[model samples]
Each structure stands twice: as structure tokens, then as C-alpha cells.
Target chain A: MGKRLEGDGRGGVEQDLLRHDCSIGEILKQRGVSRRDFLRFCSAMTAAMALPASFAPRVAQALDQVKRPTLVWLEMQSCTGDTEALLRSANPTVAEIVLEILSVDYHETIMAAAGHQAEGALDKAIADFKGNYICVIEGSISTKDGGIYGTTGGKTHLERARQVCGGALATIAVGTCAAYGGIAAASPNPTGAVGVMEAVPGTTVINLPGCPVNADNLTATIVHYLVFGKIPALDSHGRPLFAYGKRIHDNCERRPHFDAGQYVEQWGDDGHRKGFCLYKMGCKGPATFHNCPSQRYNEKTSWPIAAGHPCAGCSEPHFWDTMSPMYKRLPNVPGFGIEQTADKIGLGLVVGAGAAFAVHGALNALRRDKEPNEDTREG
Target chain B: MSNQPKFKRYIWELPVRWCHWVNMACIVILSVSGFFIGNPVSFGSSASDFTMGWIRFIHFTAAYLFAVSVMSRVIWSFIGNKYSSWREFFPLMTDAGRKKTVRMLRYYLLIDKEVPETVGHNPLATAAYVVLFGIYSVMILTGFALYAQHAPQGSMHKALGFMYVLFSDQGMRLAHHISMWFIFGFVINHIYSAWLMDIKEHGGEISSMFSGYKFTVKKEE
Candidate 1:
């Protein structure tokens, strides 16, 4: 599969898909993915895909029959944490089930080769998969310093991104950095960093923005593309609508506490022990937009806020800059800035006093300003 | 005086009267629209965009009108009659009125068996109106502050963002909600006192607001 596409990886990309779909029965039988396990995964993928339970069989047929789409996985300026987390996928490890079960033409981290051999393999993989393959980009693109700050195989990250996007069916920016420019693009962004969609103009990029987005989101996105030939519904940020549509505050388990005005007033207070709202403590969940509290991390084990810490809102764009204090409310509204409740109490007293004084003045004015015979009777 | 009819006209010029009633209508419209905007309901399906945009537009328009109307009333306060002008509130400006105010309050509470024929705005009555205006002024500022949120880069936006940053959008949101209660409280006291004044002191006190006539004692002792 590697040497045959020697020059054009597009052919190799097609063949990879062909083999994944054509030999799945034989291969699953051989690899022991098991017919029942494969069907279960299909139904689960369908559910994840947001289709009815009845679509499970169709999903099974599609999963078992769809050719493995060619995928080009690139790492730019990142910790490569997405790849590391990908290894933790609970179901069949999409990396293994799809990435391996198919003829993955190019994947830097998992590939056996390195240096000239690996570089040569990447080129072959691209040419073989052109126009039909999927491009999964991890890490942000550094546009600063002539994109020299981050490079892959002598090509700037931005350049490689453009090159791969030109002949791709879909581009998936796999983590916060690659999706929404993550922390790298936070205020005073030193790197002039950008997400894949920003780096490659006009390319339809789907973002999976979390420090490490839930792996199922990644696999589900792929399965969606494979089965439907189109990306799923997305929100304003081009993240899947199902995942990024609601405020973490809205869906948080702590929300009842918030609505009830019960809050964790101090770090070690009894309220904190009782798992009250973190809003007063500067939780940015109310302002942030994400599905963290809903989908959760590590298969619903626990999310950051659930662990009794305020949400850092890592998935939101420039969150570190905009939603700081991470737990406090947005700074005072503009004109209302100089005073809070103090203004209320202070002004109330002032006006209340002033009203008292004016009432007295009115009485004097009533006498002095009155006509000569008007008020003598009252006196 | 004519034998058949001679109408009394002591205070409240036509424009002042006009501004007062107009201010009332505009406030009602603003409060109604503003309330809906504050708690918008996107009646559309889950996929549809929110629909409170029209409600907000109406609210903002009403706020702008309310501001103009309020400014007109403030100018009127300065130049209108003894009953309606700044003089009306002048009694609240000194400490000497403490006993008078208590007496006036007692009169208002129906504590005294005999009612005073308060010809002009009474001490307590004048004070309450001033407080109402003060509350309205703060509500106006808050109204503008809330308006500014939708256009953070526009003038209103910058203004609103300024307040949101200063107090926090949540605080502003809260101020906006809580002030409604103050208005409600003011209304409760205002109507009750007005009704009481009409009942005890003068049968035509409130009607004088519309008819611009108040009857003084025919012949004081």
C-alpha cells in the first residue's frame, strides 16, 4: 500500500478506502473486531451521529461498508496532547479502528518511519489521497515570524495547511488551538496564531475546540462525514452545533445552586463543600460557550467545574483574555463601573436626605413666597 | 367674575400638562417592552434564531422617547408654576420642615381627625414626587446602559459596555430587574396617596391635574 502509491498518494488513499470497506468482513473476522462488536459500534456511532435508534442497521452497513477515507494528520504548534488523548478512545480507538483498519496514507505520530523515509512517505500519502481524503490538523498555525516559528518537513505550518486543504473533502481542526486558536491566540497573542479555517481561506473547517476535545467528538465527526458525505450541523464558530451550542453555565450540574442563589462563597467554606455555584468565585461558565458539562471528559468521569474548580473556559476563543478571573462576573458594566451596591445605598441616603431637606425648604418657601393673607391662619 | 361661569386656572400650562401625560404613556410602553426584552423567549424551534429582536427594538425606541420626555419634564420643573415648578419641591430643602413634615405625614395617614386644606403641593407630597423623578433618572441611566449591550462598538454599545465592565453585565442585568420593583413600589405609594388626598383634602385634587383647577377656601377667616 505504501510503495505502490510511490508518487501519487491519492491512488493509495483510494485503495486504503477500498480495502477498509471491501475486506471489513474478512478483516473484522480476522482482526476479531467481531460482528457483534462492530454492529454495536455502528449503532453507537449512529446515536452519536444523532440519528434514530432505527438507523443503527443502516449505520452498521455504512460503517462496515464505507471505504476508509484517506486522512492526513498534521501537528503544528501544540503539545500534541490531542494525539495523546486519541490513544485513550474508549470505543475501538477510532485511531485504530478507522486510522489503522484503513490504509492511513500519512500520520506522523503513529507511522513507523521518520526522517527522509517518513518525509517521503508523507508526500506519497498526500498525492495518493488528494481530493477524497480527510485532513485532521492538530495545534494552531503560527503566522508570526514568517511562520518559521513552527514548521513541518521544511514547510511552514500555514503553508502545509494550505497545501493539504486544496485537495481535501473535509478539514478537521482537532483541538482548541487548531479550532479556535486556543491559548496561543489569547490576547497579546505573540504568535499571530490562527485556527485551520483562518489559516486556509475558504476551506470549510470544522473545529473541535477543547484543550483536548472529547475523542468521541472527533470520531463522530469523521463517521458523520463518511456516512453523510457532509459535515454535521455547526454553530457560529464552526464547531459542531450539538457540542458547542450551549453555555456551560446553562447545563452545569451546579446550575440549580446558581438559580437558587446558593453559591460557594469562599474556597474552604461549607458552601464549597456542598458543591454550590462557582459563579461568585469567578467561574466563566456563564459567559463561555461549550458542551464540556454535558459530554464531560473521560466518559463522564468528571469535568473541571465538577471537580470543585471554576471552569477555565478553555474551549472559548481568547478565553484567557476575555473571561479572566475565570470565576468572577464580567467586570462592572461600563457607566455603572465606579459603584456597585454602594452607589445604591449611598445615593439612596443622599436622595433620601436631600428629599428631606427639600421638603423643609418647600415649607419655608410656602410661607415666604405666599401672598400676604394666604398662610396667616395656619400660624 | 361672570355670574354664569368663571373657571379657575392656577397652575400647569398646556405644554407641562402635555409633557406629564405623554411621559406617562411613554413610560408604560417602555416598561412593557423593556420587561419582555429582559426576559426574551425564543418561541421558535430549537434551531431557530431568537425572536426578541423586535421586542428590543421597541424597548430601545421607547427608551429614547422616554429620555426626551423626561428632559422636557425636567425643563418644565424649572419654569412651570408654583404648584408644578422647582418651588413645589423647595420645602424638602431644609431642616425646619421636620415638624411640618410629620404633621403632613400625619394628615396623609389620616392620623388627624381634621384635614388641612393644602392648597398647593403638600410637604410630603412634594417630597414623594422628587423621589419619583430621582428614581426615574436612575432608571433612565440603566435603560441606556442596558441598551448599549447590543452595540458594544456603537455609542450605545460603548456606553453599555462601560457600565457592564464597571458593574458587571450581571449586575446591570440585576439593576435593570430590581429597578422595576422600585417603580412598582413608587406606583403603589403614589396611587394610594393620590387616592387618599382626593378623598380627604379635596374632592378635585387629582381632577385638578387634568382640569387645571383647584378650589381655595371661598373666604379664609
Candidate 2:
């Protein structure tokens, strides 16, 4: 496998170690993660999925007993941000154990294989698992000029995605890039990047869209698939409803301040110090739908809003275009230069109409005065 | 003046007038509150004051009324008199209607001194109302789509969630915001046109909306 993956001896050893036959319980036992800790993680996942506390044991049972499912991670035109988010999770042991539970047959970034070996692994994984494997895509697929922009192992991303994702039982688009093309498909998008669903149409794509998607949601999605044998319910955007069903504003910690009309007028103001609502600072919480307020990030430490910064609406579709002017309340009207907002355009049109009507009315009045003889007495 | 007697004809039904007035009030409240919701005014000093809460309450209440008014108006278009018929909204659909619309356009453009006479809404005003109704439909859809976000599991959410297929949340908000100005533009032109028609036609044009009657010249019977 190209002289084995160099660095951190663990990668080489992990690659050699195969756990295709092991159940998640066996993996947890081997990892020395206690039953209590595993159960706690299960409960947390159940809660995250909005399942009742009673379902925690059922979730634990399902996850513990389920054999490792084959997962093929395709990283295309990506920064590897999602992988980083998962690897740097707050509770590394639990994350590690979960990863161990899944037979990750092919992952370009972390796999020890290289060149032909990596390509071989991907093909073999697809053949072995066929329709049984889960495909997790990490970035947008470049389709410009037939995806010449992004290639791995001599195949275009579009070709790779269509081949791999087309056969998976269900595909999980793991980040905003893979889900909605994110920044890669922003305005003046030169690469013609599109999400996995667009690149590989008709595939069952469950979009988990965030800048670098919170790893807990990914873990929960995997766990839910393990327990339910099907993808969780999806919203209109094909996002898992548990995570993307509610606006950040509805569940925001600073909602009290918003209702009160208290706001952070500017950066580092007294109101800002007082933990006022960031809505006035152009927080996109009101429009964006994600479970960040409840789920938080980095092990429920703090999300952007909790840290006193506004939500940038990173999880939304085409967020780069739709939720920009990051410090403004409304998105800028796109066509007539950059700075004009909808309100400005709307107000301008209204005023223009009013002015036009005024001029028309005055003209009508002057004409009426000149035509007094034509007005006549109708009696 | 030609020797033709004038008679009062009942042009607008009660439901038509009610829907018109209700829609007008809702538009005003929805515009004011919707603007505030987008760019809220910071006034309350304490969390308990609930200033934005009250504003949102008013906005939602008006939105409900507006939706109901629009729905009832659509229903009334089927049941109301020929003057308020659904056919009036599509003036260009018929040859006579197209001719009247052209004549109205000619008068408005000062190509003709005579205003086109009609028992109900003139073809031009009917066409304008059709456009206004289109805007109203968009406003309702976008408005409820935004509202549906608050209760994701509610029936309203299920019903309106498809709007995301048409517009992103922020895009929907932008559309909803811009449409308010279109309505405002329509209102300005509408008022001016009504006033101009009232003065020029001397047919109780402004009073007809309130009284449901318009003075029409009696044709030989």
C-alpha cells in the first residue's frame, strides 16, 4: 500500500487491523471504553435525535449489537474540514470507538493506502458492500468541463461520486460543501461545483450541512441508521429533521434579549458586554435552521451565538450567497451593485412611484384647470 | 352633456367591500410590523418588557387576518356578482375586455380625453388588481413559510415547508420585504387613479368602494 502510510505509527497499525466482523460492543470493549460511558454517549445521541429517554436503552442495544457497517468516505474538492472536526472532537475516546465500529473501507485523507492501492480499496469496497455500504461525501463535486477541476486516482470527482454514491444504500452529505456546494459554488463559481445530490441525482442523500458539520450530528446520524435501518426523517432540504427543523432564533439562548428589544448595537458596546441579542448585529439565527443552539459545538461547549458572535448561517443552502453582508440585517440586493439591500431597493421603488404619481397628479390638475369649459355643468 | 339619465347601480357586494378594507388594513399592519421584524427598533430596557414579542404578535395576528381575507376574497370571486366575478381579473381574456383595456390605456396616456365607462372595475383597474392578487399570493406563501419555522412539527409547517423548494429562508424574507413596496407602489397609483376617475368621470368612484354603488348612465331599455 505504497510503503504504508508514514507518520504516527498508529495509522499504519490501524490500517493493518481489520474489524469487519466485530460488533460495536466488541470495539468499545477493545478500546477500554466502559459500559457507563458508552451508555451515556448513546443517551446523548438519543436526546440529540429528539428521541425519548426511554429509547436510549433501545438505541444502546441497537448500536452495541450491530455489526460494523462499511463506510466509503469520498473527499472531493474539500479542505478536509469535516474530517478535522470529527478527529478533534471533544471526547476523542467515544469518537474513536464509533469510528472503530464502522469499517471505513476507503477514506482518502486518513487511509494508509496510496495511489493505486487507494483506488483499489475504493473499487473493492464498492464491490464487496455494493448496495449495503453507506457513502459519506465531504465536499462539493466539481463539474466544470466534465469535472476536470478535481480528480483523485485519475478519475474526476463527478465520475467517482456517480460510481460510489449511485450504489450506496443511503448517502450522507457530511458538510455544507457536499450538501449545498457551500463556498465553492458561491457567486462567480468558476469550478461549477455542485452538491452530491445534484452530481449524483436519484441517490438518497441525507444532507448534514454545516461549514464543518458538528461531529455529534454525524455520529448521531450513523447511530440512527444503525438503530433504525433507514435514514432519519428529512426536511424539505433533505436535511435530517432533528438537526435542521428549527431556526436558531427559536432556541437561541439570547432570545430573551431579542424579545426585550435589547441588542448589541456594535462590537464591544455595553450591550454586547451585557450579552444582548446579536440579531441587531446581523445574526442570521432568525432565518437559519439548525440545531446548533441545542447541540452546540466541540462537545456542547459553545456555538457562535453562545460565544456572543452572530450565527453566520453556515448550515444553510447557498449560505455564502444568501446569508452574507455578515454584519447586516438583510442580504444585499444582488443585481444593482453590491451595497443595496432589499429595503433600499423597495423604498427607492416606492418613493419613485410616489414621485411619479405626484407629477402625474399635478399635470392632471393643470390640464383640468385649462379644460374648465369641457368640464361643464352636468345638471 | 348628452340627454342620458343617470342611475345608481350596485357594483360592489358587501363581501367585496369587506375583503378590500380588511386587506388594506392587513397590508398596512403587515408592512409596518414586517419591516420592524426585519429591522427591529431597540427600545425596551429589560427582558420583561417584551417589545419585539408584542410586535411579532401583532404581525402574526395581522398575517392571519390577511390570509383569511385573501382566501375569502378568492372564494367570493366565484360566488360574488358579475361585477366582482373572477372573470373581471382577466380582462385581456375576452375581446370586449381587451378593447375596454386599450381605451382605458389611451385615456390614461392622454391620447383620448374620454374615460372608458364601465359598471364595475374598468379593464385596466381589473388588470392591476390581478397583478395585486398575484403579489398577495406570494406574500402569503412567503409570510407563512417564515412563520412555519417557529413550529416545525405543526401542520402549518408541513403545509408550507414546500416553499423552501422555491426560496431559501432569507430569500423568502427578501421577497416578502420587496413585495411590501410593490403593494405600496400599487396603493399610491391606486389612490391617484381612483381620485382621478372620481373627479373626471363624476361616477362616485371613491364613494362606490364605501357605498357599494356607482352612478352609471341609463342606457335605452
Candidate 3:
């Protein structure tokens, strides 16, 4: 278990990372990515980074120069959805080989080591790498009931995270659970779940806040870090500015449909199959931010909106509690009048209630004797 | 015995009336503009965008007017009619005013079918108006908060920073949208109260708000 350098984390994950020891040009020879395709990808990444065309050369040089970054992917209290989303992606296998050697130090599902051996190997990588590795954390940070919600080797996840992220170059929070406490921390989160930023405030936390973030977003963000020697400029939410800089409504594929007032009002309607905008279906795209519309999930196969499911806005914090009734436009305002939401209801209640109060106040105002006006009183 | 007529006099000054009417105009514009912004129905409408650019133009113009009105109101609080003064805006904080408020509520509830009259504003209406102004001030605070977002790191931003925190960016939006409905509610209640009071008193109390006169009967002694 003294597998310090070439990790035993991903079971045979180091093999996947090492399998592509050949240069990208050579790898492309096998995968069939042409010179044009590679350049196009480089240019897209540069633009996504918000750099001018001139930066394309630098991006090309950096990508060509750096070997894929060494990665220590950690899975905490989460379903393996993030892993599934990445590995089970459509045919183009670029995502599978993003890391030159996926030195997965302690991925529970994929790692080959058992119990003490896996735990021992994890410590070895931390000691060996010191400060030269990317730590990608998936899922939420559970701290409930003394961190008993999810434990690895008798150590709470909070304990494991602090150990892994102690001196990492940069930390990538891979999913909503890791980025903003997805459903696990929805409401009355018993696990004391939190995103990495809340978990480690001092570290440079690059949040890819999605239920399952776009694989390309994670790749570009990592590659941008590799090429530029720093994380990309981030928005207030600590999300990479390149991906979360614009609202989904600002560039949605269904944007034209929203502008045209073409909405699929009900399920099983013609508009639904015809693929109208999901705004009316409670698409959180207007309020929520992410790069799904542009990035296109599953190697450009489709996304939630494209596949006819309204986005639940898993990226936004407390989304389940905040943006629930996922198919409604207005979130229920707390301490507000209830009979006041649907159109005409608030108006009716207002008129009726106002009239009743008015009649009563007027009757009291009547049958009164004239008294000294306060304004007219002698000083 | 001798008989003579006495002047009832004006409780509100010219500037006060001007501020009030101007505020009314601004609120009307603000409500219409804000509503169009809220529900921008563009089906079968002429220009293709559901954003209602024209209404937004009017809305912002009214916002400027509203800003002026607020500035004037702040000044009026310091220097205006005694009845309109900051102290007079609230009922006496004395124990008597507290008792009067309870009495007024009970009176309205017909717990005692007797009417109580006092000078200026009754305790109940005075307290309600104070709350009314408080909400208006909040609307102003939130409106400026939205304006600051276009450029968020300067004097204007810092000046209104408290509002940004009071209602964060999202809350600012919710307040702005819902404030219009609050104004609509105020308008409905305001009109009914004024008309009903006018008919009950037979003093043309509602028209007097516009004509600035009230005829009062004086008995000779």
C-alpha cells in the first residue's frame, strides 16, 4: 500500500491515466480527432475562458506543454452519479482520458485496495504530493450526528476532506452537493452538509455547481488551470466566470421560444413534443446560472431542457427548499398572504377586504362632535 | 348675544399639497410601469419583445420623479406644516394615545357603538400612515438597490449597501415586484375610505382634499 506516486486510488484508474502516455497527436491518431478538431476545441476553450483570439496560441502552447494534471478524485457522501455522468458519457471518450494518470487516491467504488490498504495508500499520496496535485471532491460534506452519516475507515467525511485538502494546489468541487449542498442538504439537512467553500473557506474553491456539472466544464476549468497556472476568474459564487458568467436564459437553446411566448403549458401537449421553452414548466434557467445550454451534456447528446425535463436548478443553493414546486414561476414568499398568488385572487381578496374595512371605519368616523383641530390650536 | 363666522383653515401647506399630488402622480406611473415589467405579455402585440421597453422607459422616468419626491419629503419632515412634522406624523407616544388607539379599534369593531373624535389624525389612521410611509421608504431603498447592481462598487453602492443586505439581490427583485401590488392595495383602500367618509360626513370631505376647503357650522353664543 506504499503506492505513493502512481496511485492505487481508481483501482486501475492509474492505468486509464497512464494508458494515454502517448502525446495527444498520437492519441488523436487512434481516436480520429483531426488537426482542425483539436484547434477548434482549443479555440472554444480559449473563448470560454473569455480571452481574445490572440490568447489561442498561448492556450495551445500550454495545453500541448503540460502533461495532464495529476488528479486525486474523492467521493464523499454521494451517489456515484457524478462518476456515472463522467464515465457513462456518449461514445467520444475524451472525458475518460482527461487526466494523463487519474491517480485516484481513495475513490471508494473504483479503487482496488481493501480497507487498511486503501486507507494507507491515500495517506501515502498526500505525503508524497505535498502541494502539487488537483483534488476533485464529489458530493456533500456531511457533519451531522457527529459525522456518522457517512464515514470512511472510522473517519468522518469532514475528517477525510481536511486531510485530503490540507495543501492541495487547487480544489474543484465537482457537483451541486459539493458546490452548494445538493438534495442531501436541502431542508432540515440532518447531515450538516455544506459545499467545499463552506468546508474550507481559505482554499481557492472553484465551484462547478450543478447536480451533475457538465463534464466539459470540469475539463475546461481544469485545463484552464493547467494552462494558465491559476484558476479562471470566478463570479461571486466562486463559480468559474467562464461557465457561470451568464444566465441560462441569456443563451438557452429554447430562448427564442420563450421570447416568442411559445410555452408547453401541460405535459402530453403538442408543444411539449414540439420542444417549446420550459420557462412555464418551472425552468429555473432564468434565475439559476450554469453552462449546460452551451456546454451540452453527455458529449453534446442533450441536456435537461433539451430532453424535455424542466431544470430543477440543482446548482443554486438550497434549491430544493428555495425553488421547489419545480414547475412554478414564483417561489412561495414567506409570511405573505396565501390567497394572493394566482392571478385575480389577490385582487378579489383586496377589494372585498378593503370594502369591508372601509364601511366599518366610515361608520365610526360618523356621529362625531366637532373638536379642536390640532393644527389650528394656539401655540 | 352675537354671532360670527370662523375660518376652519388649511391643515396642509401649499408645498405639502404639491408634494402629495406629485407623489400621487409618480406612484401611478410607477405602478403601471412596474406591472408591465412584471407581466410583459407580447402575444399578438405589435413589437416582438415581451420586455415592454416603452413601459420601462416610463418606469425609470417615474423612478427619477419618485426620487425627487422622496428628497422633498425628507426636507418637509424637517421644515413643513406642524401637522406634517416628524413628531406629528406619529401619535403622542403618551399613555393617552395608547388608550385612544385601543378605544378607536374597539369603536370600529362596534364594541361600544360610540364615536371618538380628536384633532388632526386619529390614533388609528396616524399609526397606519406611519407604516404606509415606512413601506414606501423600503420601496425606495430596494429600487436603488437594483440600480446599484449595474455598477456595484462605488459611492452609490456603498450608500445603499445596507439595503442590498436587507434584501439581497434576489430579495430586492421580490420586493420590487411585490411593492407594486402593495401600492395597488393602498389605492383600492384609499379610494373607498375617502368616498365613504365623504358621504357619511356630508362635508364633501373627499372633494375638499382637491378643493382645499371644508364648510363647518358655527353656533352663536
Q: Pick the candidate with the highest DockQ.
A: 2
For each of the candidates, the C-alpha root-mean-square deviation to the true structure, in angstroms, is 12.6, 3.6, 5.5
lDDT of 1 by residue, A28-69 (tens): 555556677677667656655557889888766666666666
A best-first ranking of the candidates according to their DockQ comes to 2, 3, 1
| lDDT (Cα, tens digit) per residue for candidate 2, span A31-146 | 67788988888888998898899999999899888988888899988899999898777886567656766777778888767877678778878987799999999999999998
lDDT of 1: 0.66
Model 2 lDDT per residue over B1-221, tens place? 32345788888999999999999999888888887888888887997889999999999999999999999999999999888899989989999788778877977886666555667787888888889999999999998888888998789888876787888778888888888888999999899999988887667899999999888665323
Candidate 1, B16-81: lDDT as tens digits: 677768777877887777655443332323222334445656777877887888788788787776
Misplaced by over 4 Å in model 1 are: A1-26, A90-95, A101-103, A332-379, B1-221
Ten-residue region with minimum lDDT total, candidate 1 chain A: A368-377
Instruction: Give each model's clash number.
Output: 52, 0, 5
What's the distance in Å from true for residue A304, model 3? 3.2
Report, for every candidate in turn, its global Cα lDDT versus the true structure.
Answer: 0.66, 0.84, 0.67
Q: How do the residues A126-154 of candidate 3 rate in per-residue lDDT, one tens digit apiece?
A: 67676877888999888777677878798
Any runs in candidate 2 off by more than 4 Å, and if so which? A1-18, A368-379, B1-6, B115-117, B217-221
Docking class of 1: incorrect
Per-residue lDDT of candidate 3, residues B1-221 (tens digit): 01224445455666666777888999988887676555544342222454444565778788888888867876887897665677665665877667777766775566754334333345776676677777788788888766654443446766886774465344565666666666667767677656644543344456556655543433211
What shift in Å separates residue B100 of candidate 1 from its native position after superposition? 38
